[model samples]
Target chain A: MHTETPFKTHFNAEQAGLESLNIKSSNITFVSVSDMLALINQYGVEQLMLGMVEYLEADFKRWLDFDKSPRFAAHSAEGVIELMPVADHQQFSFKYVNGHPKNTKIGLQTVTAFGVLSDVASGYPLMLSEMTILTALRTAATSAMMAKYLAPKQSKTLAMIGCGAQSEFQILAFKAILGVTHVRLYDIEPNATKKCFNNLQSYSKENDLNIEICHSSEEVIKEADIITTCTADKRNATILKSDMVGEGVHINAIGGDCPGKTELDAALLNRSDVFVEYEPQTRIEGDIQQLPSDSKVTEMYQVILGEKSGRTHDAQLTIFDGVGFALEDYSALRFIFELIKQNKEAQQIELLASPEDPRNLFGLTQTHSTPSA
Target chain B: MHTETPFKTHFNAEQAGLESLNIKSSNITFVSVSDMLALINQYGVEQLMLGMVEYLEADFKRWLDFDKSPRFAAHSAEGVIELMPVADHQQFSFKYVNGHPKNTKIGLQTVTAFGVLSDVASGYPLMLSEMTILTALRTAATSAMMAKYLAPKQSKTLAMIGCGAQSEFQILAFKAILGVTHVRLYDIEPNATKKCFNNLQSYSKENDLNIEICHSSEEVIKEADIITTCTADKRNATILKSDMVGEGVHINAIGGDCPGKTELDAALLNRSDVFVEYEPQTRIEGDIQQLPSDSKVTEMYQVILGEKSGRTHDAQLTIFDGVGFALEDYSALRFIFELIKQNKEAQQIELLASPEDPRNLFGLTQTHSTPSA
Candidate 1:
């Protein structure tokens, strides 16, 4: 209802035609959190995850085509707010996300994000979306994509180390992308495990997945072919040790993203063949931030592009160090934009000004004649 | 209407109280182009200009409190899109703007802009607004603020070079701020001059001022006290030369923004004492881009802060290099946010998501029981 009709009744045909060609109508599609939820319901999570992974893989293959930059962060005492902007020749995308570990204590989300995709030609925003849910999906998809190349061929069971906000998403993505059937879940807090169990119990029954809630992380680690560590701690606490991680298992380490916040022991990271989304950003924010600056790591795009070897030996351990790059958000935005294009129910709101004569910008607001001194 | 009421019928008393404490209501005040126009119509331009100047001065005086960076720009064959971000401890702001000089040929705006202001604590956006009209007003206010300090105190008449989209705002700003009673306008295209003449003819009559449309820039340049050059060409243009400028005449060079886009001759710059906002950024985008890297320039903030002098002598030629900065947009956004706060009619839309339990983001969109592969 908020959208302005392209052809207004007041405009003459020539004026309407001219206005239609301008492409500066000052409106952008706005997808609220509820709208995104509705989209997921309509399309189904498996379908959305599968579609998102396809876009992510396609974008990652052409990594060099994108204008990539580390997120510009404004760190404060409480949290950090970042702007991650990336562009291709035709489109530009940016995500505004925050990381605040203590927000959960006060019943606020620890992480919340929103993003915009604009046309490069006019720099006019085409879509504005709630990215909190989308980020969870993309992060899970990125992990699954990495596991597809690096995990052992017969991998079927996943070890979910944290069982926090992103645990269900990771499980769902693995199921959709890798055909993963079994999941072993563990969390330091028993209530977190209960929440995860309550949320995904119906999912497990419907999908024919063997979901087990384990008593300890070690119990789950022994059975997992793929290990995903997504703890919410803000310190360098070792949730996985070098000895505990088995050979041939692919480790998806996501929770250890900020500097000084890592999940794996240094000894474990030193032993594994680590792959990263972007080396420059991962070195500073990923689990490898605990490693020495000169530590060797493989870029994930190279593996995807077939320039580097993946899972060379049956017993070799692989680690996917994901700090969440800007390009992944770009891919997610592109995916959602495509969906919105197909669905007319995606609501839009006016955000820009399109004056009939761009030169008469002030005339858009007619002025008062009394020039009071 | 897009805004979500925090207390839905489903919420219990405790949940409603908790939701009230957390300000993540998914609603953000949005000011559209039409809304901004209505605001101006209600408040009057002179009043808005005066208030904006006050906010601009207040922000400039405490310049060190802000985090400043050169705008991040993406250039193409046609034009450029830029992201300018700035923040303090409590709040963050960014502007997405594009400059496409050829756009007007196709009935599109040569420049379009929008911006966001968010709370730094939670990283939630507070407002989204159409910035094209706001930018025009703020640019004119900044020029007027500079002219008050740099121009001769007793100056009256004004000469406006290259009458375009921003010309009327500049004239009105001078009239409101400096009590300038006369304006002489010139442009390469006679139609542009005619448009300017028509727009301000009623304004001149209301304020009892002399308004002249000259055939050439020379006719206006000879008798003006303050000269403002605001051409829209995207190349190095000599709209004003050294011999044409007189003693004690203040020069407001605004059109010469962005690299390789300038209006004044290098010789004219060489003869005047140049003042700039943010030296490092001005070196790349302003008229001073033609000068040496180590060229002596006074920071406008220093002049505002009383750390440096302004307009030393009656015959001194002073130039205020008016390259728009992120902080000016910040000031503009702050001003608009205040007005919206006072008046609820300034419509806001839901741009973020708020759930009963922040951790259950996926729960917002309830998934189907059957997970089809």
Candidate 2:
């Protein structure tokens, strides 16, 4: 007899939960935003980011393992809500993410998200966790991961155009992973800049990095080592124009991720060595949306796989048109799940009912039942 | 002054202390199979069905009020999982559902589900509820509502193939609205037939009707006034061949709602008057998949909106080829929300976290401090 409980009967947010509930029961797991943030803080942002990068790379390597689509987006005046679903043989995941730049006005984050990880075999949800914070971590890490491949080895200074909720993470990630030392920040709202400045002041001390607050996009981007534009809103706002570009500046375009939304000018994309997380998605949602059909852009995975060069040269302008991918979510989730495992401090929330007999679904109400022969 | 809550907070099965926590907080309401059954029995199936029917009509009449897509489905060897999303001005709703026939032998229901309802403008989740029981109610109510419009004036003698979990609800719903006095059951598994027979026998007394169990699919199909094929599986099995169908039959083809999974044959679809919940989705998932691009299938909404005819004569063969719609789930959530409002017996689950200042997302974990300007 086996000493270990058959994971088949044991239902936790275990790694095996995906295979069992996905194929075996109508089981679903739920993790909310508060719990997710707690998990992130417990895990330490460095490990979380690194883990996400690794998982993202693994998924991208087996790119053929996924059943993917470009994502279905419903756009509004303030922002957009998108559904990104991708699946492989054993597992499937989809994200419900909203990008409302104006949500902060009413005391809400610009992006609020959640996701489901289900079994490809049974289609039962194995886990559900808050992706809002995870999305930020993953998005920032993904950008940093790309910059690691595409930016100069000694890159130190970073210019941030959008100093909102995402600004702190983007700067910190680059500093942690890319050896970035100095960060220059700019935002349309001075209060947003002040918030980012204060947040980064503490983060900089913890990470041992120097930071500066700038008044204009030109001031931030002028002779920058690497530039990151994470501006919000559903507009074709060109915070970074080609005219202001300096040589060898790697652009991490993070905010413009839906149709009719972009942070860079068309001329800038035409002039840079453009790379994307998912080419199909980027063509519609990334900075490439401003470019022509014949414009060339490399898929980021190719660079990661070593099939192609990243920046190619120190003097080249490398643009990582980051439009947030499902792989990033998968990586972030795997990281969080691992953190939850290592630190048993995080509360385990339950959202699925384990039926005594899965088939007698109606018996869920009945406390006692006799199974018919 | 208005005092009612403007938003509905959502909780998952795991958070509500259910079996699984594989869901994120957002526009998703994850009801474990157990939660759904609990809601159904507590609210009583009759109240739920009637409530859903009322919402269905309201939604259907304001048909253009939704951001509707036919549906997007992904099929695998074990089964199929589908994403059905719809949005109105005020709210948006989507359901994640799957069908796997082999699940029962391994200990699982053939279908399992969870859904999300959100505010379209705010991009925030209003409510999340277990929809498995609600799905059963909505599915049956949708069929009954369609029968009210499409079936002959006096519809009785409903023959149900595959008398599993769904058949009980289907029979009861038809009995309630369509005055379906006669029901004949058939399933490959005699246990399923016995279960359905026993369940409906008890139900018929309350509804004032009669229920019968038959061994052969063809015998029941031949005499049935309304033939309902609710078989569970992936293979393209023909529960009723064209030869078995009678002239005046209203066929509710519920089982065939996936790409590789179907029940009624191509010949049956061609000979009968086919009506679908959504034409584009039905063309791919319904028995109509066996038909051609030019296949003339009528939208059920058209008949309801008076743009198309239902049954012109008693002898006309009618088929309500329902593959479940987002609008139906929309109606289900709406019905449940209304039910919880009217009846104090409804249980309230906590799914979302309240942070005083959303920007201090990190402060959610620490002692509260006023956000600095």
TM-score against native, each model:
0.90, 0.89
Superposed Cα deviation of residue B346, candidate 1 (Å):
3.7
Clashing pairs in 1: none
Clash total of candidate 1: 0
Per-residue C-alpha lDDT of model 2 across residues A1-373, encoded as one tens digit per residue: 0023111222223343332223343334445555665545554565556666666666666776678778877666566677888777767778888777677777666677778777777666666777766777788888888898998768888999987667777876787678788888899888778877876576678777878888998898866788999887777998888889978889998888888888898888888899988888888888888888668999877888888889878789889998988777766665555445444343332334445555555445445322110
In terms of DockQ, which candidate is strongest?
Answer: 1
**Fnat of every candidate, listed in order:** 0.42, 0.26
Once fitted onto the true fold, the runs of candidate 2 whose alpha carbons sit more than 4 angstroms away are: A1-28, A342-357, A365-373, B1-35, B342-373
TM-score, candidate 1, first chain: 0.91
Q: Give the CAPRI rating of model 1.
A: acceptable
What digit string (tens of lDDT, one per residue) describes model 1 on residues A36-151?
77777777677777777777877888888878777787787778788888887777889888888787776777888888887777666788888988899889988988888898
